[model samples]
Target: MHPSTLMMGYGYEPRLSEGALKPPIFLTSTYAFESAADGKRFFEGITGKRPGGSEGLVYGRFNGPNQEILEDRLAQWERAEEALSFSSGMSAIGTALMAHVQPGDVIVHSAPLYAATEKMIDAVFGKFGVKWVDFPAHASPAEIEETIERAKGLGRVSVIYLESPANPTNDLVDIEAVSALRDRMFADAEHRPVIMCDNTFLGPCFQAPTQNGADMSVYSLTKYVGGHSDLVAGAVVGTRDALAPILALRNTLGTITDPNTAWMLLRSLETVQLRMEKAESNARAVATFLKDHPKVERVSWLGFLDPSSSQGEIFKRHCSGAGSTFSVIVKGGEPEAFRLLDNLKTVKLAVSLGGTESLASHPAAMTHLSVPEARRAELGIGDNLVRVSIGVEHEDDLVADFEQALKAV
Candidate 1:
């Protein structure tokens, strides 16, 4: 069944909720067990005293009605076996990484990552003796394998983390190739590293990372899934067994999404398909307008990509679309780029993406600032690059605003 069709009512029965159409917020922090025997069984599953049959909710930290239902819907969107929500995208990423690695373990990651994520590697993960190695998002499978091999030499490669259709740059990463190599290299190993992809840039509608080869697809639900720019949440969806450890970690760390946020996500998922598709359509229109402008040096939207190259093939094999968030390099460098952004009257100057209204920001000055002064340009995110998050705005109005804004440049 189509996900949108099922989003309204799947995993929820109104009959159990006083016949209400929508699921309630489940505001309580704990669930009441029928008897001591039932409570013992629930705790047994929670404490890992026994195996499986852990669906029974014991506490808010472990499970909640709204959280569980939202997870079910998100898992359906990614075609994953299970899903878990978190307080924020960083928390989700941190949990996913920490679940797989201990001291002396290594993480092989993709470059041009969201700046805070890069910071997290050194600030949080690094302090614990975990190491990280990075490869370009556009690297070939062989090159990536070389990076992983190098990571293994430092310590056991416990996680292969990636942010594909990379932030600000919008470059595609080869998920299928990475998954194939992981299988080939670790087939006989008892503990194989997971290929975890951040699907926030494209979300589930534009790209299915898990289907392409990733073991887990993570998202900052603050962006696309929430749709209205009102909530802050994150998610990870993968095989139940693969996510069990992350779930346990989330429980232990108390990073689970609050019931109110979970309920908001439930409301947002109902229209996510409609909202994202509209935004993508607007982005293509805006990208087309910017590409022809003399002041715009380059419009890095994937809409103009050639489908025959290796990167194109990788995109074609994985992503369903180019997505709405992309970068534009303006003429006259930083001064002109900042001028254009400052003069914008319609599009808001902001950092976050996937909202109902368009936004424009300088990645070098804002989102990717943590990438270090020298490496920012090396990563293809220069001072003149403006990252635009297209929204469900009227195409003609958006183009007109950008056109007038460019006159400042």
Candidate 2:
């Protein structure tokens, strides 16, 4: 069955709880053991002495039916063998990276990363003695190889992390090329770098990173997965073998999403595809409107990629749809961008993307503020850049909003 079809009821049995159509939230701190022998067995499973069966739930943090069901659904969506949910997207990224790397190890990542992630790698992880190197989003396959080789000169390349259709700016990273690069670089070595892709911008339906040779796929479930801005959550999905260590770290660090949030995700999963499709439609219309506007200097949207360009070819090969979030460079700098943002009536001025309501923000001062000025310029996150997250709204309404807002500038 299709993933969206399966999402309606897969991994959940209606007969389990009074024939309830929806899974009820298991809002307890822990579960009761059937017997002392059963408790022993559960603990043995937790300690790896025995295989862990899905039937038993020992504690909320360790396991829960809501979390398990949600994980199962997410794994199904991404075509993954297993999945782990986290309290936030950063927890998922941090725990997965920490599980794979140690002191003196190096991480090779693509630039224009989400600001928080860049800070975590450079400021927090750097203090812990792990080093990081970055290649530009549009780096050629050969340039990526050189970057990896340079990182290897310092230490093992433990992780190759990438955020494609990168935050705010819709830059495409070649996932298959990076995966091949990892294989070529580590052909003779016992240790291999794990390729992790952050698929938050496009979501699971638009792009499946694992299918493109990524070892693992990560997401800020707070965005499209939740569909509403009411909850904060994240997810990691991959083969069971690839996710084992990350899950182990999640268990120890208590980074698991709570039962209520898991339940919310479960509810959101039912309609995510519909919401995303509508948003994509709206985005296409909005991008077209902005492209023809006299005040708009340039628009960075996946749909607008020149077919002859290398990035466009990569996008054609990997991504199925041009997602809703993209950037617009106005005629002037921050003052003009801020004026347009401040004048928008339909789209709210906000930070996060992939929500039910449209949002717009100045990336230079908002989302990527932590990045150095020079680096931001190189990434094309200019003072005139304004990022927009198109929601499932009427195309005409959104276009009119942008028209009036641009006039304010």
**Candidate 1 lDDT tens digits, 1-409:** 9888889989999999999999988889899999999999988887777877364988999889999999999999877999999999989998988888888788889988999988988778888898999999999999998988888788788889999989878888999888988898878877799889999988878888999889899999999999888999999999888798898788789999999999999999999889889998999999999998888899988878889988788888888888889899988788999999999988999889998989999988888777788889779989889999999989999999999999888
Best by lDDT: 2
Worst 10-residue lDDT window, candidate 2: 46-55
Task: Score residue 366 of candidate 2 by CA lDDT.
Answer: 84
| Candidate 1 CA-lDDT value | 0.89
Q: Give stretches of model 1 more than 4 Å off.
A: none
| TM-score of each candidate structure, all chains considered together | 0.98, 0.98
For candidate 2, the TM-score is 0.98
Per-residue CA lDDT of candidate 2, range 1-409, in tens?
8889988998999998899999999989988888988898887766566754434788876789999999999998778888899999999999999899888889999988999999999998899789999998888999999999999998878999999978867788999999998988899998999999999999878999999999999999999999899999999999887888887777779999999999999999999999999999999999999998999998888998888999989999988899999999999999999999999999999999899999999889987898999989887789999999999989999999999998998
Cα lDDT listed for each candidate: 0.89, 0.90
User: Which residue pairs does candidate 1 place in steric collision?
Assistant: none
